[model samples]
Every structure is written in C-alpha cells, then in structure tokens.
Target: MTSSTPLPPEGHGLPQEIIDTIIDTVSDSTTLKACTLVRHDWLPRARQNLFCELSFPPATLRGEERWRSDYEEVLRSVVMDVAHSNIKPPLSAAVRRLKLHFTDTSSELGFLEITSQLPFKNLHAIELLDSDLYRFEDHDQDALFLFLRENPSLKELRLDGVNSEPKKFLHFFSRLAGLQLQLRSLYLNDFFGYHDDYHEPESTFLHSLPLLSNPPALQTLALHDVSRTEADIFVIPLLTTPSRFFDLSCLQSLEFKFPFIESDEAILKMCGATVMRFTIKGIAHRIHDGVILEKCFHHLSNLVRLELHSVHPDRHGIVLLLLEHVPILRRLGQLSMQFVKAPSRVRDSSPPYTSAEWALFGEGVDSKVDQLMQTSNPSLKHITLDIPCSWKNVTEERIREYFPKTNSKAVLEVFRIQDS
Candidate 1:
C-alpha cells in the first residue's frame, strides 16, 4: 500500500525556525490563513496571530451577525461550549482583547451574554462603541459589574460615541471606583451631557472621579469631544477641589482630542507633578485662529515633552502663539510642527512647513519661526519644520537673515527642505 500523506510545498519545507519566523511576521488574516495550510507546525503560531485580537465588522451595520467576520465563527463554537458548561477555558482564553461596536440594544444584550459565558480570564482590554449606549448602559449595570469583577485583570478601557447622563455611568464606575482593577489607561471620547436634561446639573460626573475610592492612578488618559459636555465642566474641573475625585494624580501621559483654551492649564493646575508627556490636537477647528489656544498653550507651565499638532498649517502662528505662552520661560524644548499626519494625498503636496497647497486651507501660515526663535528668555534647543524643496532656492544669507546663529546658545534649525 502506498503512503497517502501529502507533503508541504518546497518553500514550506523550510526549517521549522524559518517557518515560525514567517508566521510571526505576518499579522494580516489572509496571510495567517495561508500559513496554516503550509505545514502543521506553523498552525499554532498562525492561529495565535489570527485569533488573538478580534474586531467584528462595524456594528453600525443593521444586523448583529454582520460584525462576525472570518475568525468569529471559531469564537462562536467556543462560546457555545462555554455556555453549555462543557467549557474549554483555553479556547476563550485565546481572546485577550475584544472590541464590540453596537448599532442597537439587542447587540449589546447578545454580547453581554457572550461576555458572561466566556468568563475570559485573559480578557484585559475591552472597547464599547455605541451612540445609544444609554439604552443598555443603565439597564445592564449588574451584568456589567459582574463582567468587571470576574475579569479583575482588565487594565485598559475605551468608551467612544457614548452620550449619557453621568449618573447612569456612575453606577458602573462606582463599581470601578473601588480601584480594585489595575486600570492604567482610559479613553473617554465624544461623551455628551444628556440631551434631555434641560437642567444640566453644575457638575455631577466631574465630582465623582476622586470618590472612586481613590481610583487607580491612570497612567494614560485621553479626553475627546469636550464641547459635547455643557460648559467646560468635564475638562476644566478635573483639577479643582470638591470635584477632584476622578484621581488623575498618577497620570504620566495625557492627550486632548478636543482643544480647549484652558484645558491643559486645568490639568497642570490640578496635577502637574506627575505628567511628563502632554499632547493637544487642534484639528477640531477648521479656522484655528490662535486666539482661543494662545492662552491654552500659554499654560504649559510644567512638563518635559509637549506635542502640538494642528490641521491648519495656515495658522502656523498658532504653534508660535503657544510657544510664546510658556511662562516657565527657560525649560528646554524642541518644537516640532511639521510632524502633522496629513493623508498621503496631502503629504504629496503639503511639504511640512511651507506649502502653497495650504493656501486653500486659509491664507498660508505666518512665517513665525523667526518670531518663535525671538521669544524672550528661551530654552528652545531645536526647531524642526518640513519646508518645501521648492522654497530651498533662497540664498543662505537670507536664511541667516531670519534665523541668525548668534543666540548665546545657538538654536539648531533642522529642515527637511534640501540645500539648493
């Protein structure tokens, strides 16, 4: 009798070490599926890469099943076993990260059941995306709390497109307020005050932070869509008394998705001692006149690193306006504005610092490099820009005209624009 077993293709016959490398290198699902067929040896690693972190199709679509793509089928089989009490812990254990975007209430109910059954011990990260989080949020507080208590190791959470009365969430966060979970990173984006609350309370949720039993000091926190909250209560009062329960004193890095004039100042005023990295995105404003953010930047009293990214390069002075506000006067900084992440189409034309393509954005940015360089009592060691190659034809003497290399401490001028 002839042996009927088939052999893997020649390249697939490579040493197990090299095959493992190939499996480990590719994270895209299609490639991992192809690897699974190559040899039995690579199947474990390939499946690990393929199934570890899963994203359902956008829940914004009409049906719940629509979110399940390729690997979700495997997950369903494991969920069925777990639900039946013939649980295979290792199967659901593979799912360390899970993201659920719910288009409707039924989807939330379905997933909560899945969550309860899975008892995913390794589930350390969870993301909930729902515009109508209100329907399920308050209704399922007990189950949600059970999910949290069961998975005490959960360290990161992201809530996006959530608009609710603060009180509804307090029930959930109150459970979390105990600070039992080692939650280090939190992202609250597009959270709005309840639209029906014709009488918006002075600050119900903002005051609840510190009360969470001195909630775990989050190392990373990002606050987005501050405008959704009535007044600046959500962002500004974080550092003040009576409402300071949200416990940000352990913060190491913070990002502002929506720019507020006094927002940065508010955090520093409350807990500047611990924050070393600060980032602000002003992309919210199409016409970013420096008037509002000028004071915002001025409040950078403490911090070793600051990142300021703007959408309107036309208002290049917006960054300079911020640098002028550094009241500390003599702290070292390397201001980099050309790092704006424009799309490939925009990058093709919008050279970092100087671009006429941006003339359409607004009047092109003011040449405030000289103005920023001239700001008094400066500790600026370097300034970086992405000026156009076309603009590089200017004589070196003219370059020196604006940036004289004669400060007591010579400031380094770095540009992507090549020498003419």
Candidate 2:
C-alpha cells in the first residue's frame, strides 16, 4: 500500500471569533500587516487595529520642518485613502483616537484647517499636545471649534502643555459646553493661562462661563503639573462645584497632583461617596498630612483602588501613616505605592539609606500590612510597590523579608520603573 501525504489545515477551520481573539493580542504593526495578507477574513480586524489611532508627524520624528512636512504628507495620504479605499467602511472609519501636535506658526494653521475637514466617523478621543492656542487667529480658532463640533462621538479630551489666554480658554470651553457632548474623561497637564492680569482670581475665569453650569458628566478627571494659581482658580472650583462641569456623585476615578488643602478636603467630602478609584501624587514628605488621614479616608468608604504616588524618596514614614487610613476602606481591593525619584536639580542629595535604616522602615511597613490583613478581611487582594530602578533590588528584598506573609500569599507585586 502507498502512503498518502496529509494536507495542511485550512485557516477557515478556526472560528472567526477565535481568529479575532488571537489578532487582538497582537500589538506589533509588522505582525499585524503580515496577518492581513494571510487571509482576507482577517483584513478588517487587522486594519481596525492598525488604524485605530492616527498621530500626525509620528511621535519619533524630530525637528519642526521635518515633522511638519511629514504631517502634511500623512494627512494627504489619509484623506486620499478615505476617499478612494475599496474597503466597505473605509480605513478612516476605524480610527477612534487622534493625537495632533500644534504650534503657533502660521503654517500650522493651514494644517489645522486640513485636519478639520477629515472625516473620522468613530473618533472618540482627541489630544492636543504642545499647542499655543492663545496665538491662534480668529479663523484658526474657528477651524478648531468646527473640528470639535463635527465629532459628536468625542468623549475624551486631553490638553497637554497647552497655553491660552484666560478669556480665549474660557471661550473655548463655553463653545464646547454649547455642543453638549457627553465627555466621560478630561485630562489637563501643564496647562496654563497667559495674560498680564496676574491679580485676577482663577475662579473668575471658570465661573464666567454661563454655558458650563450644566456640563457633561465625567467619569474620570486628571489634573497634573498645574500651577498654584491654576489650581486655586480652576481645579478647586471645578472639584468643589461638580454640578458646573461634572456630576461628582457619578465620578468613578479622580487623579490629581496637588498639595493637600482645605479645598481638596472639601472635594473629597463631596465626591468620596461614590468614587471607586483615587490617585494622589505629591512630594513624599507632604503626602501624609494630618488632615488628609484624619478627615479624607472616612468619607471614601466606596474606594476600591488607591494609588499613592510620591515624587521623592519616601523616607519620612509615609507608608505607615498612609496605610493607617486604609482600614476604613472596607471595599478596597488594590493598593499601589510608587516612589519616584525627583529631578536632580530638586532632588535631595542625601546618601543612600544604610541597611539598618532599611530594616527599620521595612518593619513599619510590615506591621501596617499585618494590621491590614487582620482587619481588611479578604477585600485586600493585591498590593503593588513601584520603586525607582536604583533601589528596586534593596526595596524588594526588604519588603519580601519583612512582609513574609503577604509575599507567600502571592498578593504582593514589586516593579522597577524608570520614572513615574
């Protein structure tokens, strides 16, 4: 008898759902491109992942002239593809997020105009980075406004390193308020208001917007690296008066980097009832304030996830004091403590802690963990320690030695990070 060779299995033998699940796990663009050529049935999902996010000029590009030229070319190619692609829904329809870097230069205004005209039906998030909106001409500002207005599906907006005059910024929000888009998340980092009137209170800028009285309900809000004036003027007012821009009662996540103050305490009192996730970033020494521990956690009964990010070496016993306030959170499940090294110019130049000092500190942390385990029941499922790269080994060893119970239970996780 002659032996016959068996043929390779067909790709169609696997269910489409399984194929999609496998493709979803692939993140490399090169691999995704290769997957598209393997079977026609895989093309839609592959293209969706490939075009889900569109960034102008590419993040790796440097130099203004080079990036600007690349931006124009990419924009042109995208527009042409959208208009002429043979695919049913078109490649642009798969885009869900856009990241655009803008400048005050006149040439950039032209780019903005062209961007405003692109058709992105499913776009939901927009990030304006390193932009100086204060210098935009009337037409340029109108173009941006039109772009935002056209995207009714937009639900997340992030402004990073963006500057605008107080009046102009307020006007922008006022127009956005008119759109009545249901924004679910907003992040403002290194945002500034530029004007000669430094004496004016910050609240006036936000309070003046009549249309913002009933703004969209946001689920997540983040304010980072904001100046003191901006915090006092914008952040405090927004947090304290949730009805103006957000419904704090429905807010699920809040992240901010601010020195604890009476206003911040008041914010906790308001939103603490429902917020399930909370993150606070500050200098290590200032994070464990008396009032915060005494007054804040009591109101956060619903908190499920808590992240304390310290921008300096936490040698001042923040762990014990902060953890002392955790027992009140009956629903707490995840806790993340991060120690970030500050910049060299501002960092303390003290010598590394001696082994004796590490042992003492570890004991305190261990005792706190013991109390949490005894009192928190099974709700405390995971604990994470994010230490700076330089101290990762020492910290992990000490933590594992001191927190033997937690380590053995596999509830402890330690990570080495370059920066926070």
Cα lDDT listed for each candidate: 0.54, 0.70
List pairs with backbone clashes in candidate 2.
none
Tens digits of per-residue lDDT for model 1 on 1-420? 433344456633555566667777885478678756855667666665666665544335425454444234444665676456532324356566777655454444444555555646666788877645445554366566677777777788888877655455544454565644488888877777664553546465545445543456678888776663433544344334322335676678777853454555565556656666777666435444455554444444456566655434344444444555543434536655433333333322354323334431222223444454555536566654544444433333334444544232465454544322
**TM per prediction:** 0.66, 0.79
Residue 349, candidate 2: C-alpha displacement in angstroms: 16
**Segments in model 1 whose C-alpha atoms lie over 4 Å from true places:** 1-49, 58-78, 81-91, 107-111, 131-133, 137-139, 195-214, 231-245, 261-264, 284-299, 317-320, 326-334, 338-367, 370-420
Of the candidates shown, which would achieve the greatest lDDT relative to the real structure? 2
Tell me how candidate 1 scores on lDDT.
0.54
Residue 345, candidate 1: alpha-carbon lDDT: 37
After best superposition, candidate 1 residue 186: deviation in angstroms?
A: 1.3
How far does residue 294 in candidate 2 sit from its true spot (Å)? 4.1
